[model samples]
Target: MAKKNSNDNGKTFTTQQGLNSYIKGICDIMRRSNCAGALQYVPELSWLLFLKILDDTEQREAEEAEAVGDSFADSIPEPYRWRDWANPQGNRRLNLQMGQMGQFLPFVNEEVIPYLKSLKNKPQATPRQKIISEVISSVERVRIDTETNLLDILDKIHEIDYIDPTHIFPISQVYEGLLLKMGEKNNDGGQFFTPREVIRAMVKAITPQVGETIYDPCCGTGGFLAQSYEYIRDFLADDITPEQLKTIKLKTFYGREKENLIYPIALANLVLHGIDYPHLWHGNTLNREVIYGDLFQDAPPQFDIILTNPPFGGKEHRTVQAQFAYKTSATQVLFLQHVIDSLKPGGRCGIVLDEGVLFRTNENAFVQSKRKLLNDCNLWCIVSLPAGTFVAAGGGVKANILFFTKGKPTEKIWYYDLSDVKVTKRKPLMMNHFQEFLELLPNREDSERSWTVTREEIEAKNFDLKAVNLNTKVDEDKSTAKELLDFIEEKGKEVALTLSVLRKWER
Candidate 1:
């Protein structure tokens, strides 16, 4: 019982499928425009959709308020609202008929954006107000010059039927899909996204409880935090109480991001998912002065659960490095220490780090970090991912998810090798793929990819957390490295092609 229709967008699709296809249609339009890549295209589309949704939400809120006789001040002014200008015929200032591009574009450019930009200057702006202002300031300019392209894209965006409750999840999927595409582009925007499947697996295995605080120190687009929320919400089923729901909404999830452009998207993403203006700080988590300084009420020093995929193998400035006692510029090492410090005594952590963190003795920083991790935490499991795990992020980096608990040192660490499966943009790793690992996790059962090594064995190995799949013969790294190189090379060619196709937008 699904609707079907042949349209210019593509083949016939059900409501959810059609909405998802509409998102791709917008991307196809952006691909032909001045937008250089998915990084540019995704954010532009996100803001437009966000505005439309905001407009719809406001209209509903206004109606409900009037029904209840409650006073409500609209977050956005009438002139800046989406309904005020997007429709040519309905717009009071645009006196134009349907199919006409009258003052819609101009109103967005001259009136709406300017109003958003000016809000930060107002005295005593709320956190939500500050976030809206931040979004407007960091988002890219509209690069689609042709009116036809602009209007066509609008047609696709307008297909998001906010009027129906059934459309909410599908519309959200449309937004998340666009973000995933941005991450897949492996450009600056790619930094905003972690592969969602990996995040879901981490959240599921860790299983955050209700009323417990969940946090992500380097929450790019809030993938881990959002997944954690979704995991708990579904797990509780109808058993979730009103007070518990309030706690989840107002206090459960917390995060911070350093990127200016990415931070706003993180806010928008979490807000869209029902956490009312989440407690995500827009600053470096490693910066003691910024993080420790009284900034946000939501920014806490410790957490019940920490889930994150921090940037890999990067160095901090010497000035920033001085903040940590470790006295090294290695970013991931510093983040590891921060996580350890940020967790409550019995708190759990699921973090992603490069393989070098486990075994690299060349630098004292890496060795020290591993030593600290082993000594202070019960390092339960390490899921060593496949080579192409992050191909969308431009390279094949061998990484692992470190699942641990504070207050107890690790006696025996469990390891799982998931490197056999090939993952790429076209073929992604799904949730079902993790079922095997999940089944074995609770009992610490031994299997081909799952095994246990005593802490004494780890200590003898100098805290080197490499491929510990002892039962089977480990393959050589040559093929994996070569495949990764080939993948990167192909990405480069795609970028070159994209440049050629979108060269006209460069001006």
Candidate 2:
């Protein structure tokens, strides 16, 4: 049999029009059931929802064929061939067919089960299975359009098979990773997914060396590791010998967990992306067994590069044992210590942390740690991200990335004033501004948005890492109400003029 051309058949999956309708129907069903949360965690819901739509479409085709005496049902694909299985009359056959899809769903269910149970790391199957079953059946009730919409969504989703070994990856990769973003932000759900551009910028700056060990103690959806792998391979063209290729393509490059509900997603993501090394684990990094007291003993096999976006401001502190060799008030502080300790003396570390760690007055231990970072290590740079970068979760909390080396103090620390960069999905307010900062970054001296500062300057202000201390160049950049309103008015007129031009151009 000849392979089908999607454009010619106008039936094969991958068409954009098909995708939009499919996404619309899924979003609609999820919204109608008021179980959007299920879409967030319940893997069964995604699978059965997929099956229900597939089966419903298949049945419609079978009915149409039978009416016309064509009987083309037997020619359907493996997934779409669920007509005999969705039969309410043939329960045994239905169970047998669903069993195959059930295998994949079970794996996804494991990822979200931990969140539902409130048990970190451990699997809670019985109740999670019951919940998944109910959610799946409910989602299954939401009908997909048989005539046109079904073909569209299936084509879109099938473009990158979730299971194909040859393909690069899928949006399910984004979905699972977003949960980690949600967990990192401590949002209502997935409100703080690092913009893809932000992830790209972080990966570019970190410059993950191929075959070099890397870990994100708070590896949300393995974004740092995933992008790091791609960036290094793409830009550097690091050779992967046949043997290394096998290992690189199938091993875990970093570890990650999100209340256990997203671990499978993380693992699945890694597998889908051709990473098989730092096999992601399930457990809270701050918990006693994992992060507290001698993390070397807890988290074996130290890494070369530790890059992550750890959880933001929260009261998750506990009087942990000799877990940390250093001291700090917040868990973020403790994580910094753990990340430092996890590295070899020459290892590099990059992490996103709330601004408080940079300048907390009462935290003497944190202050001492900052001193240690300045005097004993290469405290290279600090880049302040815009406030709206994390607008959904840590909206108001200012954040900066602390990039440093583990060994000895390198002369001057660089500071980049990126506080003005607006973070949004559209044109002007995007995370891509970080790349401009990267381009302007100096090897040893100062450049735009990049300036060198020393411990003496930092100590002058009681050791504050905020942009106000080091880079006084932009001191006069504040906007008054009148200036802001005038700028807004000018922008409005520009938009109206542009719209008029567009209308004329279209005509």
Candidate 3:
């Protein structure tokens, strides 16, 4: 018989479905409590989940320390621990629940939240304590309206055991599902998340090693960094040394996020993904404003690999634009310049850029940025993604992935076009979509779907490096009027029959 986990309602669950259903139940409660959207609820859930995981991790550590007759000091002390306050069977929770009807919410808001938020201010705060403070920095108070709803959420969160091997998937993946909800259309979190498939392909192409520093200038929910960690861990497998593992977990990934709502979520997301120390600076990367740099202290001056999808189509202020060599209000153009300058000599980068950056020579900044990229890096490959690729994330812009290496001037550039391939919210761009591109990426081979453009040719067109597939045949519409009318009639009959059935069902 498999080990089972029981929720507060006495229902037992053991599989991913059970976990997902449990999470959905929590979300349903959150919805009724006014956290109706992912943007509203995910931030509230992130801190709760982070504390739960933190307490769980410390509990295991305490047990291990006892086994070795060593002392253990938890980063979160006393009543602030998740077990003390969040767990239903815990002494503090039982006391509060049994003593008064409405004490739990006040206690959490007044005592527990402030305590966690003040961890970094302590005279002798551990690194873990500092991390806990940073992760909950944006959380002012529990957003769930009623005490009952908040308690219910806590109960469900407590049931999630991160160390349980019986569960088929990692609990971290459950947090990823929450982040995915944030990225859904109209959630307004699409800006924080790139499609996971895109991040995976970029990480695979970059092939970041265990020791190589990987950074994301705009790491929304730390997806690129998390995926890179998984890639490196899987690449090394059993051959990985403890030192290398420590480096990967503690020092390998770094990022900067400006949004108050997103920075803490990024920390929690990366921590849930097993990054113990995600050296993320909470600040505006463009304007060089440092909101909090304690976690990012001692970070490398430059990185070995940068995988990012900088926010698309946002205009920066003059202060931000002034910081970049290429003065442009276009956010993506400034980010491109930052990525270029942040790369170490001979470093590689894989970045997602919109179509405007590729073909827009009207903007001097765009042309200058492209020129700098070509002059400073080996502009290896550009994969033109199809339209509606980001429809699930509510993005409608046509985008491309640019793969390049610094310390080498561009001679020629390979281009892989998937613009003809149709994608929608229902049908997203998958890893298999890049099958031919990945296979031909090594030698820069030319196929009907792939081509190359030389630097000289690009300069002739004033550096318009858009992937214009020369081999794609533009087929002429040769059907007669009668044929077209027949085709339309057939489709109209199908639609009429469907509507007629639907009308009968309505009755």
User: For candidate 3, lDDT tens digit of each residue in 282-358?
Assistant: 89899988998888888888999999998866777888888888897788889999999999999999999877789
Each prediction's total of clashing residue pairs, residues at least 3 apart in sequence or on different chains, is 1, 17, 0
Better of 1 and 2 by lDDT: 1
lDDT of 2 at 44: 26
lDDT at 75, model 3: 87
lDDT of 2 at 478: 81
List TM-scores for all candidates, in order. 0.84, 0.65, 0.89
- Which candidate tops TM-score? 3
Q: Write the residue-wise lDDT of candidate 1 on 1-507 in tens digits.
A: 111111233223357777677677788898888776877787777677777666666677677777777866667666676665553323543553343665455655666787876775668766556656666667545667676677777666655556543455566666777777777676444345778788889998899999899988888888888777778878896899988888887788888888776877877777666665577776787874342211256556789999988786466787877777675676778899999999999999999886667766666776777888888999999998875667665444567899999989889899988877767766767788799999999998999888998888877877787866667665666667788897777556644533442332122
lDDT per residue as tens, model 2, 8-40:
222233554554454445544443443344334
Q: Which pairs clash (backbone N, Cα, C closer than 3 Å) in model 3?
A: none
Candidate 3 RMSD computed on C-alpha atoms after optimal superposition onto the true structure:
7.9
